[model samples]
Target: MRNHLVPVTAAALVAVSSFAFAATQHHATGSVKTYDSKAMTLSLDDGSTYTLPKSFKDPGLKTGEKVNVAWQQSGTMKMVDKVTIQK
Candidate 1:
């Protein structure tokens, strides 16, 4: 039973680690369509929206601002790791 359990545990660990590695950061550039401070979300012109993590500082962004965003996806939720507003 212990032998069987070892493989199962190892497989589970590998699966979890693979999932973590797969959630690497990605970049997007677009004009902001909307920014909801209350909801902590920003929508881009390319139709991609990101949820800002609470730990992330406000970039003083506004609707229609062009931006470059670094984000990560965990399941269905998209979280912004960093954002840069374009001039």
Candidate 2:
């Protein structure tokens, strides 16, 4: 029984580790829908919208433009990186 339990525990640990490895990282890429500098908002071309943080300080983002949004997980999700005005 002790010998059998060792293999079973090791197998279970491997299974759990595999699940963690398969987890998806945070990422999203889409065209810019709307970027309101005053409103601090960003709307992607994918019919999705996100509000920019007040700390965000950049330019050259406009409506109907292309953008690649790279975000980080913060409870919900927060934009940590972005590439705007891309083809």
Candidate 3:
């Protein structure tokens, strides 16, 4: 019985961890509506806002420029992992 229980617990933990990893990354593409340098946030024309990581450097992001953002949701905020400016 103990041997069976151990396998079941390990399987359950693996399943739960898989779900966490699956939901950890997300992506978005849109034109920039606003960028607040002080707040370290970027707003898209679609109304979704993302919090840029502190280490993020200004990539000459401009208003109305199309951008692709790779990010993760942290609490009530979207934390950016990378930002790519579109041509």
Candidate 4:
């Protein structure tokens, strides 16, 4: 009886942990499509568009720049976290 109870508890814990892990939350990636001295427009690979704030996009990005961007709600909104320029 004790052995059976322990196994059940462990299984419950495992299931809860899996659920928690899935709720960690994450953002999608985006890329730089156009840039200028003040701002830039980023296009996500998921076919979404986002505008980078002037404070962040100032001096703009180059063409074909890949950036680490986070998206909200099916890639509607995006914010660039990191930019990696490709040759």
Candidate 5:
């Protein structure tokens, strides 16, 4: 029982740490290479892809437009919560 305690505790810590990292919100600015309203995905000119939230409102995004994306990582996907077009 004592030997099993350490590994279990370590596993719990790893699980918590993974959620902590995932909760971190990230921001990026780039030119829009493509925007798919139906698919709800945004691709930057630099090759980074972000998935827009389902309830997200359109910010009048267009190809070649500069935007600031606020997103969070969910598993393998970067989910965008907000988008601000740059003047």
Candidate 6:
């Protein structure tokens, strides 16, 4: 019984880890509509908005600037992982 329980627990852990790793990462390209430095949020022309992590720094982002954003969903928020200003 103990041996069976151990295998079952290990399998459950593996399933949970796989699900966590399978969270989709997304990418988008659009012109910036707004950037709130204080709020750490960015809105794009495509009607998508993202919340930047606190550790993220502005890369001279401004309204109407073209950018490519890489992000992933974290609970109810879309968290920005990377941002690149498009020339």
lDDT of 5 by residue, 1-87 (tens): 999999999999999998898689999999999999899999999999999988988979989999999999888999998899999
Q: Rate the local accuracy (lDDT) of all candidates.
A: 0.89, 0.68, 0.93, 0.56, 0.94, 0.94
Q: How close is candidate 3 to the true structure, as a TM-score?
A: 0.80
The weakest ten consecutive residues by lDDT in model 3 span: 18-27
Model 2 residue 59 lDDT? Answer: 59
lDDT of 3 by residue, 1-87 (tens): 987999999999999998898678899999999998889999999999999988989899999999999999878999999999988
Flag the better candidate by lDDT, 1 or 2.
Answer: 1
Model 4, residue 65: distance off in Å is 1.9
Off by over 4 Å in 4: 1-26, 36-40, 57-60, 71-87
Per-prediction TM-score = 0.73, 0.53, 0.80, 0.36, 0.76, 0.78
Clashes of each: 0, 1, 0, 0, 0, 0
Ordered by TM-score, highest first, the candidates read: 3, 6, 5, 1, 2, 4
Residue-level lDDT tens digits of model 1 in 4-27: 999999999999999889879999
**C-alpha-based local distance difference test score of model 5:** 0.94
**For residues 1-87, what per-residue lDDT tens digits would candidate 6 score against the true structure?**
987998999999999998988687899999999999899999999898899999998999989999999999888889999999998
Off by over 4 Å in 6: 1-17, 20-22
Q: Please give the ranking of all candidate structures by lDDT, highest first, separated by commas.
A: 5, 6, 3, 1, 2, 4
Q: Could you tell which candidate, 4 or 5, scores higher by lDDT?
A: 5
What does candidate 6 score on TM? 0.78
Question: Which candidate tops TM-score?
Answer: 3
Residue pairs clashing in model 5 are: none
Off by over 4 Å in 1: 1-20
Q: How far is candidate 2 from the true structure (C-alpha RMSD, Å)?
A: 4.9
